[model samples]
Target: MYIVILNLTDKKADAPAHMADHNAWIAQGFEDGVFLVVGSLKPQGGGAILAVAEDITDLEARVAADPFVSKGIATPHIQQIAPARTDARLSFLKDVA
Candidate 1:
């Protein structure tokens, strides 16, 4: 599993230029089953993405594909994790470890 943090770098006024493409990129991630969760960061810092992939390179490629990254709207930091524990309902996450 991985936690992808996107820290906003571009001005808020620049959002309109990239939001549509960014939203589409996010939607595709979910549709592809790579992104497990995604949401805004507190105080509008940026956003966070929970994702899983067989290889970190694949995850990196996906993150690179995000419009936010391509447009220089935000910087993404990917933290890879090996889940050693999880609730019974989410035990499946262990497989990604």
Candidate 2:
């Protein structure tokens, strides 16, 4: 599993120009089953994504492909997680870790 943090950059205001394409990228993540959850970072600073994937390298490439990251609207920091334990509802993630 991975946690992708998209922290807003000084160019945040330029985000509107690429909003549609960014949204399309997000939709593709869901469509491909990589994104488990996608939501804002609160106070509208930026966003975050919870992704289930086999490789951190692959996830890095996917994040790079995001319009927000590609266009400098946001900077991405990806955290690779190895789940040693989880609540029963999230047991599936343990196997992946």
* Number of the predicted model whose lDDT against the real structure is largest: 2
Q: Write model 1 residue lDDT over 20-90, tens digit each, in one string.
A: 99999999999989999899999977999989888999989989988888778888999998889899998
**How do all models score by TM-score?**
0.89, 0.91
Please state the error at residue 88 of candidate 2 in Å.
2.1
Error of 2 at 54 (Å): 1.9
Which residues of candidate 2, in runs, are more than 4 Å off? none
RMSD in order of candidates: 1.5, 1.4
Clashes of 1: 0
True-structure RMSD for candidate 2: 1.4
lDDT to native, each model = 0.88, 0.92
The segments of candidate 1 whose C-alpha lies over 4 angstroms from its true place after superposition are none
